[model samples]
Target: MWRCKMVDLLIRILPVSAWKDRLIQWHVPGCAACSEKLAAREEAMSVLVQERELVSVKDFWPVVNRRLRSGVEREAPPSRPAWQWVSVAAGLAVVILTSLWLNRAPFEEASADLTQKLQIDYIRIGDEPARAYVFQPKGVNMTLVWIEKDGEGE
Candidate 1:
């Protein structure tokens, strides 16, 4: 199938002086299918060439410009208006700001409460001495014997 198409293409494109023309002519006589395909392709090409309208070079630019303008008119409107773009941006900004403003107070309160708790824990751990001596070593066994001294564990 491909050989027939290739031979048809070479016969159409190659000049008379090309050696491939003689080769194709030799092959076409032996191959009945290739000869038939080449005949059909040549007939189709001749009909197409004869039916095609030849445009003058002077009239070509006007036709091209008219078609281009018509195509532009048929297409959708180019870009959105500038004001529409600005309004969309403003809307997105307002939504983002409102969400941040609504959440600001709780976030601040949580941060302050965490700071206070951490400070209180630090103070209690540093100032309390009885919390440290609750564990005592007694002959290879650990014991929690609290001996109360005055002003201690108060």
Candidate 2:
């Protein structure tokens, strides 16, 4: 029952100005196209307002301080920095393990094969008492001296 100009004046003053009763009345009754146009206009206006530039950060600080003082607090969760020491330690561990593994000889390799290949006689001894046997693996003289004494258990 209010005048049409009264509704327009109210729309100009309200914050969410587009969803007024007068506009909805015409747009909802017999026109889908008009309703779509109104929705599109509202969306466009909202995007334009967001994209608009304000004054510098200096001028903006007062507004921010006012909001903060009014108990409007919003914060992001804290985050940790990248794992430098953990990564370095992991890398060092990997390097150490790789070095150890690379330096080791396999157990299944024949000692005779290595002795013959190297052309040097290296001897291995056991805990027995009779003789020092000589092994010529590829004609390299390797001796096994059996010491017949309780060297440590005596």
Using TM-score as the measure, which candidate wins?
Answer: 1
Report the Cα lDDT for residue 50, model 2. 50
Q: Model 1's lDDT to the true fold?
A: 0.64
lDDT string, candidate 1, 1-154, tens digits:
7877787787677777566768676778889886664557667777784534656436577888898878965766646686799889999999999999999878766765654453211223335532223443433223353433336545
Q: Which 10 consecutive positions of candidate 2 have the poorest summed lDDT?
A: 143-152
Q: What is the lDDT of residue 48 in candidate 1?
A: 81
How large an RMSD does model 1 have? 24.3
